[model samples]
Target: MSILDLFKKKPKVNGIIKYLNLEGWWLNELSDEEREIILNIYSPMGSENSIIEGEICSSSQTQLHFFWGLIGWFNKPELRHIAYKLISKAETFIDKSSEPLDVHFFYSTKLEVFYKDRDLRPNGLELAIQSCEQQIANAPAAATAFKQKYDGNLPAHKGYAQLAIILEKQKRYDEAISLCEKAKSQGWAGDWDKRIERCDKRAKA
Candidate 1:
């Protein structure tokens, strides 16, 4: 990446570097090519040649901001399978020794990826569910777990809300309602009443 950095790299490359540079990120477990692909998916440039020896590059914004990361990447149905592969591997490679909240956030990302990747949905949902539940139980607040001179960047995972939405989508409306209720009790910042109302209506329907 250092040599790649010597040249003007694309947004994808820059984004991957940012993700890897995140404290406790373990990008070494992945190959250079794989890292390029992971970042490239987040690039708004669609598909293009991967960074090559001495190739000049450019960057841009698209339908979504690059800050959206895998969230934006996962929505591309054509690239969805690739995202599943990369995210699953990233989940393994992520350093658990990082700040607990960061760890929780990455694991919460798995819930979003699995829920969105309909083909890979069934096998991984339970893992995401359990992980998120534990996260909210343990580190329910960002400041509580992060404990640094606060930047707006590192915040608590919306584990309760994310899990509730997944549960709602799965038509486990009762569980969804219960989860939203728990989020409200825990003081998660979201419209829980509305979510609970929607879930209750669905449950009855």
Candidate 2:
């Protein structure tokens, strides 16, 4: 047998679930040798091809698992670009598929990352807004995901507030107020009332 045949095959679903149950211990507690072994085994599943642009595949369920597994590396400054690229591909896959609204949370999260990094790519916010709108369109699913999955980060509501603020800045009071109301109804716990009142007064003036 070849040298590659000596290592065990990739873990299955139960193995992944067990690893996740360790709550970040897998990476946080890994020794250099163990880490190297994992990298050698799984890197090809999620890694990009240096020679080709956008060559990473996220079209299948297995690939999505790989993509998500790489998300933990997003905390590392050096590996953030890889995380960004993987999620970008995942977003495209989501756009073309019938994925649930909650799956699009990364649209805002990734945009926030790019914004903080001052590396907003062309159409990034546009994509985020589109995904936010989709979430609003599927209110129940988004709300449940916000409460349970996101620990109440409320990405959809936050995205609406963001768009509302932009509209308010543009003096589009009606649209801004509409979005503010949507955000409020979608469990936004911010000072949207004041903004809505301001929009109302401005719209009447």
Candidate 3:
């Protein structure tokens, strides 16, 4: 079965039961049936850590250990789903705290998760655009933060024009064009005029 097809099926209770049966040392002391029930409750393909943590706090270490073991079993899409949930939870926690660095860390982790996982590349690009837009919206003053972080040159200027292409795909033409202009102004040495002209045509069309 394709990975997508495997994911479409509900995670099998038998699989979890078998795993737990063989690795009972990793679980809190529970009957085989009880472990089966717990697995049934938390065995969904993309189950969130928070949900698992809440249910298994009696032996949270076991859950963590199990995840470590299961890590090899997860395909990229499954990993992406897990990483995204983790990033979302981390963002929420960061928002509730007074730590700006925590927010940055979570966002950075989110980007890394997207970049490292091939199955997530498309979603990662989409998330990158959204993240940049959010950064611009929430702190318009820091619109150049990405540029500053990326060597004082926007992605469009650094031969990473693919970033602009992604923005255009998201229908964020103005932002894409603005990025193209920024790239041109920064002297990163791309055909900025052609890019701007293409964006203009896209905007009009």
Best by TM-score: 1
lDDT of each: 0.56, 0.55, 0.46
User: What is the Å distance of residue 32 in model 1 from its true position?
Assistant: 7.5
* lDDT by residue for model 1 (1-205), tens: 6876769643333333343343223244545665556656544465454322223344443211222345446646665666556555555543445445545555565556555544565756676676577567655444455545454444434678778878988999998888878767655567789989998988888
Over 50-169, each residue of candidate 2 has an lDDT whose tens digit, in order, gives 111233233343433434455544634555565565566555545434334435454455544443443355766565556456545655565764577466355435566666776887
lDDT of 3 by residue, 16-110 (tens): 32333423332333355544543444444665542223333233223223433333222255445544543443343333332332233334344
Indicate the residue-level lDDT of 149 in model 2.
49
Candidate with the larger lDDT of 1 and 2: 1
The candidate scoring highest on lDDT is 1
Could you tell me which residue pairs clash in candidate 1? none
Better of 2 and 3 by TM-score: 2
Kindly give the number of clashing pairs for every candidate: 0, 0, 0
Descending-lDDT candidate ranking: 1, 2, 3
Per-residue lDDT, model 1, residue 72, is 41
At residue 47, what lDDT does model 1 achieve? 41
